[model samples]
Target: MNEDNAEQGVIRLLRAAAHTVGPGGRLPSVRTIMAELRVSPVTVQHAMRRLTAEGVIEVRASKGAFAATRRPTSEVPDLEWQSVALGAKPPGDESLRDLLTVPGPEMVPMSGGYLDPELQSVAALGAALGRAARRPEAWARGPVEGREELRAWFARQAGGAFRAGDMVVCPGGQAALSTAFRALTEPGDPVLVEAPTYLGAIATARSAGLRVVPVPADADGVRPDLLNAAFARTGAKVFYCQPLYANPHGAVLSRERRPEVLAVLAKHGAFLIEDDFARDLVIDGTPPPPLAADDIHGHVIYLRSLTKSAAPGLRVAAIGARGAAGARLRSARVMDDFFVAGPLQLAALEISVIASMAASPHLAAAGAEGPPRRAAHGVGGQTPPTPARHDPVGRHAGVGPPAGRRRRRRTDGSRRGPRRGRLRRPALVRGRPAGPAPAPDVRRRAARGVDRRRAPAGRRGRGRGDTSRIVNLRPTFPVVIPAHR
Candidate 1:
């Protein structure tokens, strides 16, 4: 073998020997190793040096090599005092940690409202980032309230009286939540939220030292009467709401209830923090205009996020408000990070433009190629699951009615009578028909093995028909129920 391979083999042998010997035990001598492996003294010396460096063995100046002793527990540094200095952790910290925990390779994550890595728009985001990087302005400092074009885009999405001046770009939804909570309310102040709201919102509000009072909400969204009562009871000046596609439960505020909710906010003299994060994720039909769009009186502070609709790394979101609230949001964002990175803002703008243009009828009229259109659609042409219906009661609407309740049809195409039997009991084996036992004579013959097919006399005890090799098929169909038995 070559010198390198010989040296490596010697090291492996020495390592194994070191592990075999107990702590502080003497290992085989260098001369003995050289003699046994039929290698030169240099190989043994090199292996010993490496093992010594690795702490697997120790080589004294005069003494032979020996296994290194493991350090005792008492010799290690103590860290228990840090626990006393840090004090108690905040509530829901563990839950938040669990929520944010990334699933391992073996895990199939079903919980949490996040897009799988497979579903994320990786290619488009990378391309957009590349485009953004090519632009010289993208590397410069951006406005604290974000670029005017991006803000204008957000304003148009907000749809009503919202303008570019009212929009403040933020890092992400959580950061935007933190900024809004800190901006609108003071410490120890009460903030109203829906009963089954986003966990991140709850955690953020609590971290900001605000008392979270839950206003009862159902499938139709938060009840206006309870919301008003909650405001009065808690004396809260701010209410955080998700009118469209509320997280966790995915409830939307009904049209009839929208006016009532607005009236309640006016009655209580409160500001509604509208989280319109999932505005772009429509799977079925068109979503309604944002609640902030309907607010002409400046009671609503609208927050929209692109993190969900776009790739997760595209952490761009906007908070839109009319008057003083808008200014407070802008100031809060400035204090948080001065301003979002220019390149990220530019990349986000690029992605938004591509998505919007792809959806426009004008793009096709411009004679864009099919590949380019599909590429603009995003990674694998996959989009976030945002049901378009105004009031989708979760994902149940997409799934058909339960099997037992399904009605049968007649030959004439009219409705048939109610199911008489146990819904035509399913068979144990898929394609095989289920029925009663065989005739008495057949059963007797089977018991005696008289009617069983067998191999020729000479090959009976071997080959495919060997009794020991034959598999019993009786247990394969475990359950065989019949219509008449």
Candidate 2:
């Protein structure tokens, strides 16, 4: 009669029916069980749920529940021989693994290498992906070098002499780095990297069997002298560096040091793998051009990625080189994953997506306008002669200074500058300076006249029986607090 008793009775009847029907037989319908047992549908559903969870029955959508099939158990086989067949443990990148490990819900992550989920343009990216999915070409296999349009856009981003023909679209920055490492060097060859470079680069190089040699870097980026020394000492053919906003340190290679770095590479006849990962993340001031832009003889192999600026799912990156080096990178990319997914490549280059990303506050500062406007918009048809000061998606989108006012910046990101005169005070406050305090009014005071001279010291000028004190909350700031008796 009760819910629990009814449920148990229904479950018992269903079990008997299943036994009678044998395995894989249809169980009694909920309506039939309810009609025969005189029980509610909830009771029947509860019993069915219990049976389903216990694997005593299987529920198929549209079709009624049926008895579950019982398969015979087999003996477990040992996998110990796998270790012997695989031989010694391959080098483990514990740091890289830890970097990629996601934290639990209770944990607040401070170590994640990617942009915070709060800052990602999830809605825009999703919409773009949806649009891309509808295209017939998105499902088709793209060129191994990547979609032509995407490559051309990357060329524009790279600036310099790099062209669409020179670009190889890879899955992401990490994959591009791995492909470059494998393509350029043989196993056990020394590859020079900044001392505190991106861990993914180190992990990729080591995984590719290349010996990583560290070249010290400072606030201005990798030290030219030390880099030169390392190249001479190790005879390394490849040197990886982050020119703008280097990972971990946020160091931008200084104007003075950029030429020196290139000279060092040229002297050693080595290649510089410039990872311009943060090119689009410039919050203030103009970003410098990629080191690859200055290279005429192909000493620089440039890499630019949208993964950081856009959502992490937009793992599109361009790895580019010139002449023979470019061919090697393209060949290497073909062997690794063949080509990036067509939908992802198309999404990155889609005009709608590019416009959406440019307008997104997550990608740029709110209300930032004016440009070579080319950089702020999508790169579709022709390539520009020079790269824009910032990545199109990551350009600083702050409004420029008003006419005749020179803009200056402060540590807190507030704008300060010279103005013609003091700002007009509110007239409603009777010509008195507008601030936290109320303006003087003789009429108001006279009407509510209470002799301030006769009032208690603590209550003077304040409402009746005021016992408040202004406390100095030192080390933070002073605030008015009420001191009750």
Candidate 3:
């Protein structure tokens, strides 16, 4: 085709897309455009580039292209990444680790949690590999809502002993979370949250352009009345909390308070985002039923993570969404990616099944079955803290208890500067009140919360990928824990 014809064809596609978008209320994929425009791959690319650049559409990583990003859209375009192709440039000096890495930062890498797949049980993974290869049928693009087997297993696990029919597999806890945020809040809307809930969820809310209003919490989790007050004060639409083994605090919401919390959520028409993260490793108490357990109104969007339980490599999480919530959550996933990874999801399904059997009384304890030997290195700190499930970088970016229980914060919207005395990156924020406040004491850095993790170098390969992380995993997820309220 001539260049002029190409341009005309491109214009034709754009107008068609605009019309299609007007009626369909969503952007069609490149494939649909090809079938519709009856053009080649290059033609669709040319047209999409024009649309995305013109602010008429957006090509969101992982979520695919959507309508132009507007207010309450996303936290920062820098963070919402999909696949990091090998050739894909590293965050171009803005790498995730860049924000965390400190200058002269030669400490014993004990700053955070890391889930190296090499540290996982290879024998079980090998069996899973065989299962997948034998059934290549598992390789097709699986449901964007996640495979039914995984959802059924998740449903069985949600709410302690709830039926499997209640659960739906979300691509990952993050995807499930973003969906929950959309389902519960509106653009430019304010919502209540645990002072320090999952950071990824916070980013997701901001991406949707939801105004965040953090509520206060202690070691036992958020105070119910305080939460209620935040709801009333902010006229918030949703209540986001990590009820069990919460992300940074590593504390479970007290069982006695779970019902009251849910009641408050229901009373307010606010859906409770009980990020039942870290369920597999409750360290101290008997796992309580999730807040979704007795959800009288379909108000709880309970999220479960597998990164901690089976393996982070699975990149799988599920949600036990009730009523119309399930349908909405599915919509968010579809708008992002038509389908979740097929083989990995199938593998996740099988592993989830294994986790259920292993955790059950009928089967021996998963941990007791065989603990992988840790490499003996002269480590300085106490036992490395178990990684929390949510992304720490996301958490570190915003530190401070939700609203009423506010802690001191640096001018920039970042975490309360690294323990008591870690190196503080005071530069990278929204803005700073200009003034030479005081010559800060450089030698005053000391550890605040004692939870430290150090995954030293020299690791073997994992079955999932040909990579080795020098640190620990992203708070390795708890296997199959029930999602019943």
Candidate 4:
């Protein structure tokens, strides 16, 4: 028999066997099915694939096919008791869920907060991962604080003041934020955050059982006056902020206000969690030094991540602090995941080095352009200037004289005045203004009975007109007829 006939025959037999054995019962082996049906192995395998896809059976690897479970449609299980057992704590993962959701193929994502796949350095990441896998100690566990070289790299990126020992490598920025929140504040302790801050940070703070308070921010960054007021009002010991290209707002704290903000934190004797997440994404020019760079009193706890500029899967970040705060963060990291996987840490280190090397040329070029201009509002420093406007005649609006009065170079390389012609005015058709009249050459062509509909794509035609005096008409013309007969 043909292959299709054999497949159908085997499917029918399997259905019968499933009904007899019921759910979770093993069906006949592939060999047995082939022999019983007197069919070739290919036919039996094809039938099995169809059965598995249709939910009639499940083929376990290296094991025979088994009947799939079929739940009764009329009776739904009671999940009410579990809710009472779980208590009344609200679900706190909505923000994270939104962040982690993968958009469908049809979606044009305007808002998920990550580098586009095209923007991520895929080749560098792949190379790093490959090199890491080949390393002798790739699988071995390293220091819980992270590799010394990797920590040193992060320290160097921050500035000359920080040291490798002051840093604790975490799985990612989100984990670093969560660990910092739990280590720095007790349950119900208030944590001050910039109003309209990173949603992930808010979720992490709440998950760590800390109360979040909003401090209003402007173009430059978080308002120092309001920040001090928030500290006095709520007695919040910890403040979380992104000083460089802050999420959502993209505000970089101004040079003048940085000192003021830091002084406020010092006055309140509170810790500032500086999330320097976008240090590498400054496309136009060099960003100002991180808030942690000038910190002398160990007031700044810095968090930097490679996952945004690099690929998403490279979830490596560093948290830098000094004194007891740093110690507590290290302990929290240990308790959280023991240590990040060795291969991943090594891969992250390789990628960081490669990315920094790649960015050096761009940084040098940007340096040559001098520093970026500060924003008038003083919030996000160095905003790009607004583009120049253009006039209807295709010249820059406020630029030197009109296009017709300008000089032009002839084919023989001599400068001559621009050739001027009578500009066509827009015609009023059907009590509405129409587009400008066609040029003289186009009117001559129309006079020769050339079909306007046969004009090239994107060219529009006016209605019928005389050869001598060209009268442009609207595309649609109203027909008038007398009442006859």
Candidate 5:
């Protein structure tokens, strides 16, 4: 048996022995138990150690095992009274728990939101983190708004006219979302969201004491008319959306709906929190520019995270907004955690720069193989070879016939007729053929359904006597079943 099974068995045996042996009663020695159970001495010792730690038994250095005094049932303290002391507050952690749950060894995971371990750039992240750790100011307290260089990098990533001042580096995308929700809306204020949106967003909004209002979405993303109606009906000032390859369902907002969405948000004079979390996860085609990129009116609050693409522990993300909204976000971040760690900021910057540089070749290759190339081939960017039709067995037409068959040469040295089998069977090569020819009487008996193997030893064929017995055993004609009786 395995070590776990052996340990379990030892534990069970010890527990049973302890029940029979009263307080301070000596039990069987380890060697005796080991011999009785046919287990190793080490397993018995380990089990005894565990029981001793549990107060179920005690062991003296040179003496054998003894059962410890058990505590009376009445002496156990009651925790029932704490229910009245602690007020009711239902946990909103179900979504977070589901998100963080690791699949078992036998399971094939296709549910989680992050990349599988194999896809992550482990070497690049390690190098970046190591380099950042060696810096003298790695542990120093950073600015409330994050490092200026990191902010500038995020600003460039956000595109458009956003400057370093407009970016606020938070711990992660979730934290950025929470900060934005709390900073923008008052408690109980309605916040608009897509109907089938990120569960984390809903949880975060509810935790921030905001009323979540769902706006219907379609294959092209959130419907502009419904969003306008939701904003007007609920009087919501903040809307959270994932425009590019949304979570749970990968749906990219169409180009046509972009302007309509912007127009609706502009008309309502509200903020659109764009969670651009899947920017780095693009496997094919370039993702559209972020909503914040073209927002000249400061209506979009862009949040991008590196944790999903890189390692999970690298909890760094950036939020970009303009004017008063950006100031509010910075203030909220400062109030939340003062600032993100300087080493993490440096590491994020290094990783982002290195990842981008490394991705350049892949991006170039993808670009070189444009739509025409992809369409000409199959969807996976390579054309599959067509099968040959001339070969009767469906093997490659260019291959020669099977072994032991040679083509006959004609007068002009040209092959003619089909190839014949050359390899001789043992029976065929001997005086008898491949299979001995059966007798006519045996064939006739077989056709008549006679069991020759079950016939008498002297019987050679279905003679008159066998025929009479077969007729007697045959079923009667026009057979019928009697009713009731």
Candidate 6:
């Protein structure tokens, strides 16, 4: 009803074009138009909503918006349709420029509000298309809880300890994560983050009406004493971690310190949310257990995404939760999207999942002597399917494990580690000594783990393909497993 001339002018003309040229006239994409008009997506979305309601243009599900036919029109444009269509000019790089008319050097193109294009993938497009094709209904309005089957799949894939009932799906990690923060704390609440942590988490916290406490971590791991002291000082309720292959530096947490960090959380009576992106991609040693495995009390909450390994476009992430935590997240998701989503780009997911699968072998290889840590909970003994681990741990006596990983024993008795979890290097066996440890302490030389029993004769986990020194990071939060049946 607030349709002033300024608001209606362009919409009226655009609607007229849609009426005459047919819905296939290909109106300017939201991106192209936004850049050209310097309008926000919300503005465009609002206008488009009106157009769709009026039946002037039919918004295609999953695909681009289309002009709906059956509107009364006096005249329809003929030749050079686009030039005269929408009363707008064509854009460059129709693919990308649609988002921005080529941002100036200082502008730093930012659409989707958050997320960097640097990490976006083209494969996501193909995946979404494929999904839309198979599940034609994917383009239609959907359930508030998401496809129950998909949600069930997510629950099933949660680290071994969880159940299908404990899972809830969300549009993205940001939503799931923000919901968690909002549920757990009040405004100005104290929370933990790795120093030089994922900036997005920092931004996410601030935007969600909360406060944060950043913990400093070295190559070995976060300083437990510092964490304990910080908790004593701030008395925070929640702790955030990207333990396994944390974003940015990709540092793996050392085993020696995993328990120490967990102890700090336990002492503080705080909850943990583990993010297992890199850990999921392990191709080398068996995957490690999640920090939630150590949970005797209901304090750990696991949140993972199909996005990192599957495809960001999937906008599909799952919450592996326990007790009241999972329920809180589910409620938040409902409030946010009411379980309703647009024609999902299910196609984009396959690309990431496939890529993640391909990298799995290398991820395992890159880990330490032991297999990757298992999530405290698992899905029918599956290694909690995921992607993104890299190859290397050093001589291979001992290096710190990857980010936030906990510790474990390897098949050949070598060290396997993850966020908040890790293991000691396999000691000598029999009369032989494996070569020096693979990795060195951050302050020392690379001294990796050695297995006199498993080492090739007197040779330790040395040479290529040796994970003797590699360590995987654990996600920042604690994940939990539940009973599905």
Best by lDDT: 2
Candidate 4 lDDT over 123-166, as tens digits, reads 77788889999998988878999998889988888776579998
List lDDT for all candidates, in order.
0.62, 0.63, 0.52, 0.62, 0.61, 0.50
Q: Candidate 1: which stretches are off by over 4 Å? A: 1-75, 116-118, 352-485
Query: What stretches of model 4 exceed 4 Å from their correct place?
Result: 1-75, 91-93, 352-485
Candidate 3 vs 4: which has more lDDT: 4
Q: Estimate candidate 1's alpha-carbon lDDT, on a 0 to 1 scale.
A: 0.62
Error of 3 at 144 (Å): 3.6
**Better candidate number, 1 or 6, judged by lDDT:** 1
lDDT tens per residue, model 2, 1-485: 88899999999998998898988999888889989999998889899999999989988999998988888668687999999999987753655654454443222222333454655667767877789999999999889999888888888778756989999998899999988998899999999887555667878888888887877665567789988998898899999898876654345788999889989988989999999887765554778888888888899999988887777778889999998899999988877788888888877876333545446576563213212222222221121211111122222111111133322211110011012122121000011111121211100000012221121222212223222211110101001111111
Report lDDT (Cα) of residue 218, candidate 6.
50
lDDT for model 4, please.
0.62
C-alpha RMSD values across all candidates: 18.0, 18.9, 16.5, 18.8, 25.3, 19.4
Predicted candidate 3 versus true structure: per-residue lDDT over 286-348, tens digit per residue: 567766767766777778877655544566787777667767776766787777667666676
What TM-score does each of the candidates earn?
0.61, 0.65, 0.55, 0.65, 0.60, 0.49
The candidate 3 region of ten consecutive residues with least summed lDDT is 437-446
Residue pairs that clash (backbone atoms under 3 angstroms), model 2 = 368-397, 368-398
- Residue 402 lDDT in model 6? 30
Per-residue lDDT, model 4, residue 327, is 89
